[model samples]
Target chain A: MSSCKFINTPALLLDLEIVQRNARLMLDRCQKLGVQLRPHMKTHKTLECADIMTGGSRRCIVVSTLAEASFYADRGYDDILYAYPLPFDKVERCAQLSERLSLFHVLLDNSLALQQLKKRPLSHGKIWHTAGVELTGIYAHCGNTYGCKGEEQIKAVAQQTTAITLQFMEKLKAIGIQGPKSSIGSTPSCSHPVPEMAMLSEVHPGNYVFYDVQQSLIGSCKLEDVAVRVLTRVIGHYPHRNQLLVDCGWTALSLDGGGRLPTGYAIIEGHPELKLTSMTQEHGRVEPISGELDFSQFPLGSVLTFIPHHACATAAMHPVYYVHSKGKIVDTWKPTRGW
Target chain B: MSSCKFINTPALLLDLEIVQRNARLMLDRCQKLGVQLRPHMKTHKTLECADIMTGGSRRCIVVSTLAEASFYADRGYDDILYAYPLPFDKVERCAQLSERLSLFHVLLDNSLALQQLKKRPLSHGKIWHTAGVELTGIYAHCGNTYGCKGEEQIKAVAQQTTAITLQFMEKLKAIGIQGPKSSIGSTPSCSHPVPEMAMLSEVHPGNYVFYDVQQSLIGSCKLEDVAVRVLTRVIGHYPHRNQLLVDCGWTALSLDGGGRLPTGYAIIEGHPELKLTSMTQEHGRVEPISGELDFSQFPLGSVLTFIPHHACATAAMHPVYYVHSKGKIVDTWKPTRGW
Candidate 1:
């Protein structure tokens, strides 16, 4: 374990203890609801983090990109679901990957996509000859829930998403394909007390593992539950502009705003008066809300921690994360990036 | 390099012919102005692109982060400038890197930063006795020019930036330092003609290689001058909702808006009627401006190219670029990423 003082500024830091706790809480909640939990690997793309989330099962996981799907498949993850609508040009690559995994599934929300999938022969014209490509499940992402105002709004969006998935499933059955499991969820819908439906076979929620300011404002988690932060340094102070520039900028923390929170971009850990007013490519501009900023409180070279507004977006920008446990660096994890 | 047909979706595609043209034009413009061009490599962090930008000189370049400075310095880039206010914690690293190169310079924008550098002994306590960590130059980024409405506004900000830089140089000289160069620039200021100041030694413009919607609106370049585009595919269509979802999202194009253009997130290469309304993590939602979108025109798997609002942010998202020239793949460049 290395000291925090030795770590570089503008680095991603993960609280391993909090991450494991979040994983266990989600797992226990899903278990209590008698539903299968398929952790989305899109948020934290590290196999080590996935191992903890899945309890080393490596059986089921959801990925946002084929690059991620191939990464986990190469490492022997059996059941992988590319959670987004399949890119038609990559159907051949999907077929090749399905041959190695026990099951590989993709999402379809519209009829045009279903028609394209029907025409595309999986496994080089081995249609119906072998289990060339298994349509493991049908899935829908209730992405609109991100814009929902409250629990009622989130539930309404979830219902609409499920109805759309059911209608799409009937179309699949009309084409002589029968009995495909249905999956629909987003972090907000899954985290809330969703009504149990017999049609739902799985729930996939990625960002609950490292809740950010967006999730907190959506009532999924508290501010204290956020497990990841960008550790930065106070570089320059502009008293006239009432701004203090930090090393962390849009490049490190991303440009995602605080979902429903009144906070501008991100919240400084322990300094509630500070507001991240704006950011440039490589400079974060922070200003005080009311009183004058005491520059002496945060001298040059002092480390300041910032919880991101969106964990997934922020995590995608970083290549490595410094994992800390019990106030010390315990491990390091490298995430697979790019398509 | 691979064929365009075989290249992956959401890939960074760089037209080498256009890039070289942009490079040549900027170089010629700087040459005509009789100002040295220390091209900022923060836009394209690749040795191949750097080679062309410097005209194979590999003598001087500007980087936004120390990691970039190290990446280029390790590969034989001698005169490298870490073109941000130096973080006090990294003074030792800057000093160590300076020892290996003919010149390694750091930027200072405030008196406090200068004082810290004065107190910090660089390279094994050679402060009082030897020439320790060298200040490459005084630099001021006219970042406010990005918000300027016209030539008059941009000129005012440029003058203010020059004034601040000159003021900082006097502070350096007062501390027994002398003869350090001064630089001040942004794409808007560098692209336009400014009053010749003897104090200014060089101009650093990063985004001229890939003029984007922002640059075009800023009157720096035309839309035809954009060199990089995100090659994506139409994956789904929703006629009832009037949305055509593509594979490129915020992760690929970023969330930067056009600086002064009326366009939304990004501009479709050949489809001006279509507007990228919003983006999810892996899906871009496009809508028509007035009439219904011709879904038949863009069938499933049809590739669509998009010019991003900010090229630097978009380019940073991709790991490799498919370089094209003369209607064929010419080479591939892998960009260095991370802190």
Candidate 2:
């Protein structure tokens, strides 16, 4: 690795053959849309890319943080799902990580968080049930982008995710608890879903794993299914202000003005009407509208891919993934967690 | 430790007593503003906070990544700077980290990067020097929003940094070169600088610690000298859309927009006339014009504080820095480099 081991030239160089062919084309499109794929380890938070997107099946996973459901439920990954919105001081570490995990999901959109998980204090099996307790399902969002949509906002978010999963199963059966089994999804209102009033058995959908530019302006996946990008390199060229600077900035692409869509930045495969208008902290001005492209022999550094409106917000600003092939770099995929 | 042994909770918690009181308050304000503190370990890229900001003074540092100047010149800290903007595929790791650092500096605003660092091949030993680089003077706009300012863009950036330091000292005395010394700084034109341009004896700001809301909308530090904030916690409550859902997202308060102000989402402390207005990853919508402050008793968990308009773009989106005090969480400050 010493073709120069400074290994941090504006860092982030993941190329495990295009992230294992973008994880086997999104795991064969969630095994041909049978659904229940789970993903969304906040997009590559890496447990070796979540064991290559869980082919070693701990199967079901989707956390946003309880430190990634206690790091894949302490690495054995017993079906997790913490997709954000449960806070009453982390309901006893989500009921002691649903008693050491066979399952421990959670999510909510308030009823005062089901009256603060119906007033805490019930994980008693000593140290929160020796580590295998349960309480699953209660998550909901299905209404992003300043949410709330038609059909009385998707039947009021499926009647508030079926009243916060029946108040988390009546406060886990008035304190008897036992988890795993309910959930929700949201690549912008579950890619056009509406009319299911929560009785969720499962549905996690992580931006289908690329579909960005604000999931194609909230129609969810369709600018040719995004799949992450931002290769970049064209070092500088300004011509007074026709601008060109690319070397990817905002720490390798992420000033996320939350996908304004088709406007400031987004070229994915280059010059398809160039955008990325301006950016600092390392430059990325771009702009070509319908002209300028000689770019002084373009190769000051070359490489220029871009196109991530949000592959999990640009693979959470990279920490390894090069995995190319058709273009070459070979292997390397690492992404455990980056605070 | 079992506080669920730490998992990606939107990271960045380095409060080792406010990072050693923000590194002894910027090395006692560059030893009372005489300037020459050197510090810019790309905003804490850890080697024990670069041995407490280089006290074991091999002094001078700036590195915005060459894997952090070869991890502090392979742990010796021999004066670095690489403040970014040198392309041509990083002139062979800037001529091999200026041949294993003794003083490695870098930063150029273009003259085809001093005609490609005077046709590359930089060195150090056997008296063969040549690679001490610098040149960032008149790139103004640390506040007019997106830089570049008056006095004819600072006397055409001081005549393009004195004709690229006399064409990089006549291509390092026609390639028989020698190294060390050459600098620049740009804390909004080095705080009223302009008088001595070339051989710029060292200076590199790194958001003078934390003066944001885009450096108080460009006049550089004012909002009580802003020093790294973003505590956030508010959970949820829409009270007919008065808004408040915060957990600080876009992955813990980043997505650096509003460099010229008015891009909204965070700035509410001492209520500078409160108004987060909108954000999402978790949520933050504050908007308290005037006060009656009860905000539903800020329930669901409370913490709130923000300052990022660019503290090295929110400290390169966190990895560690919880260094607080009086409010608690007294120690922990690591951030050498990540991605």
**Model 1: pairs clashing at backbone N, Cα or C within 3 Å:** none
- Please report, in order, the local distance difference test score of every candidate based on alpha carbons: 0.79, 0.58
Task: Give TM-scores of chain A for all candidates.
Answer: 0.88, 0.34
Supply the DockQ value of model 1.
Answer: 0.63
Q: What is the TM-score of each predicted model, taking all chains together?
A: 0.92, 0.33
Q: What tens digits encode model 2's per-residue C-alpha lDDT throughout A1-339?
A: 222123333444444444455456656644554445577777666676677666668767777777667777777877676776776666777878876776565666666776666565454442221113223444555544325434345445545664666577677668876554555666554544444433455556565544556666555545655545666677777777766777777677777754344657565464666677767666677766667656765655666667766666566666666544354555566665532
Model 2 lDDT tens row, B1-339 = 122113223334433443455456656645554546566666557677666655657567777667778877877777576666676677777678777665565666666666777776565441113223342222212233225444445445544664565466567658766443444554444433445442444445555444456645555445666556766666777677666777777666676764234436556555565667656555566766655545765665666567666667667666666654455555666555443
Computed on C-alphas against the true complex, the DockQ of each candidate is: 0.63, 0.18
What are the per-residue Cα lDDT tens digits for candidate 1 across A35-150?
A: 78888999989989988888789888989998899889888787888877778777777777766676777666666666656676666434311121445566667878888766
What is the Cα-based lDDT of residue B194 in candidate 2? 48
Ten residues in a row with the worst lDDT in model 1 chain A? A124-133
Best by DockQ: 1
Could you give the CAPRI-style class of model 2?
incorrect
Best candidate per TM-score, number?
1
